[model samples]
Target: MKLRFLPLVAVLLAGHATAQEAVFQTKSLTPEAALKAAQAALESCRKQGYQIAVAVTDRTGLLQVLLRDRFAGAHTVTVATDKAWTAASFKTSTLEFGKDTQAGKSMSGIRQVPRVVAAGGGLPIEAGGTLVGAIGISGGPGGEADEACAKAGIKAIADALEL
Candidate 1:
């Protein structure tokens, strides 16, 4: 009887150890949520006296929402989307690449990735250490300013999501 019970306990322990659970499960933003993110960022940028373009990308780096404030240069929209894609795909801030390459770290491989901009202004939207996606902003006075706005938008959304 003791030997039989030992096998049962061993099996239970193994099952518990191998129990798999979702980590950073993917989150899909409702259209309203996406719009709010864009709008809030736009308002924030305007308050700072900057006309900016903002883009939100999904976990896979695909465009989910994009908006460009009136008077923002067309180029900004393109850059915003590209930066968001880069961050979502790389699972890190685009600023990381900028700093790394500026330090002469031989970014040949990184440069080869067509979607990567290696510029500041894009940040990953993470939940529990897992990347949910990314947001990017452009058309501000500087890339750092754009990055700040993007981060603010991400924070707003993260708060709403209760993450």
Candidate 2:
């Protein structure tokens, strides 16, 4: 009778373990995760001795995470978020859009896109070959400075499990 119970317990434990391993959960980007990503970007900017505003947004062009350092200008948060929105909406880097917008506008049959920040520091976050979101940074020495921070943040958060 004891041997029989032992076999049953072992089988039950094995089944429980198998059930736990079968979950196979996958990670997705969320607002909190976006905030972590923004923090990473902000840290990069700090290393460069630049105070900046960082923004992260979901695929729907909504701001998910936003940050502005103590020395960052008040308005930079909005600007950076707007840039992130533009990047997510347009599904392209703000830098490319900024430069090409003029040429696109200059050419016929191309109209300027509204609310698009062509400046640097805006990048689209892609996951599973899909546009998951975007990150934007501003209030640095220049657009380039802002962009560098944002890029670092995006890369850092790309593979992280979202909470």
Candidate 3:
């Protein structure tokens, strides 16, 4: 009887240890959310009389969605995507990153990295203190205007972000 009880307890312990429950989870931006962000950004820029392109990238710098307004510059697409990638990959706004990169010799070499656009149009997307993605805009008269447009994009989805 004792031996049989020991085997049963061991089996129960093994089953508990082998349970496949997840201890941690990660959040990401959905396609619909990305689309909304891009559209809002484009509209915001249009209101300011600027033809613009917007790009949304996931936390790892993967392009999730892109939108370009009519008459937006041909180069704006690549510029927007690179800016979004830079913000998402680095977990910082491109505007602040540019300033930091240019301020010192030690970090200045970061500008040479491929696909790293240190401009003001890129902004990180965060939800519940976790970075979910980034948005970037281009084709505005200046980076400041581009940044404002990008901010509008993020603002459109602020309620759904659970922030």
Best by TM-score: 3
Per-residue lDDT of 93-160 in model 3, one digit per residue for the tens? Answer: 89888888994657999999999998899999999999999999999998889999999999999999
- lDDT by residue (47-153, candidate 2, tens digit) is 99988888888887888777889999888988899889888888888877777766536632232455667788788888876788889989888777887888889
**Using alpha carbons, what is the TM-score of model 3?**
0.86
At residue 145, give the lDDT of candidate 3.
93
- Scored against the true structure, residue 84 in model 3 reaches a CA lDDT of 96
What is the lDDT ranking, best to worst?
Answer: 3, 2, 1
lDDT of each: 0.80, 0.81, 0.92
Best by lDDT: 3
Residue 112 local lDDT, model 3? 94
* Number of residue pairs clashing in candidate 1, backbone atoms closer than 3 angstroms, sequence gap of 3 or more or interchain: 0
Off by over 4 Å in 2: 1-28, 103-114, 161-163
lDDT, model 1, position 150: 84
Task: Tell how far residue 48 is off in model 1, in angstroms.
Answer: 1.1
C-alpha RMSD between model 3 and the true structure: 2.9
Every model: Cα RMSD to truth = 3.3, 8.5, 2.9
For model 1, the superposed segments whose C-alpha errors exceed 4 Å read: 1-25
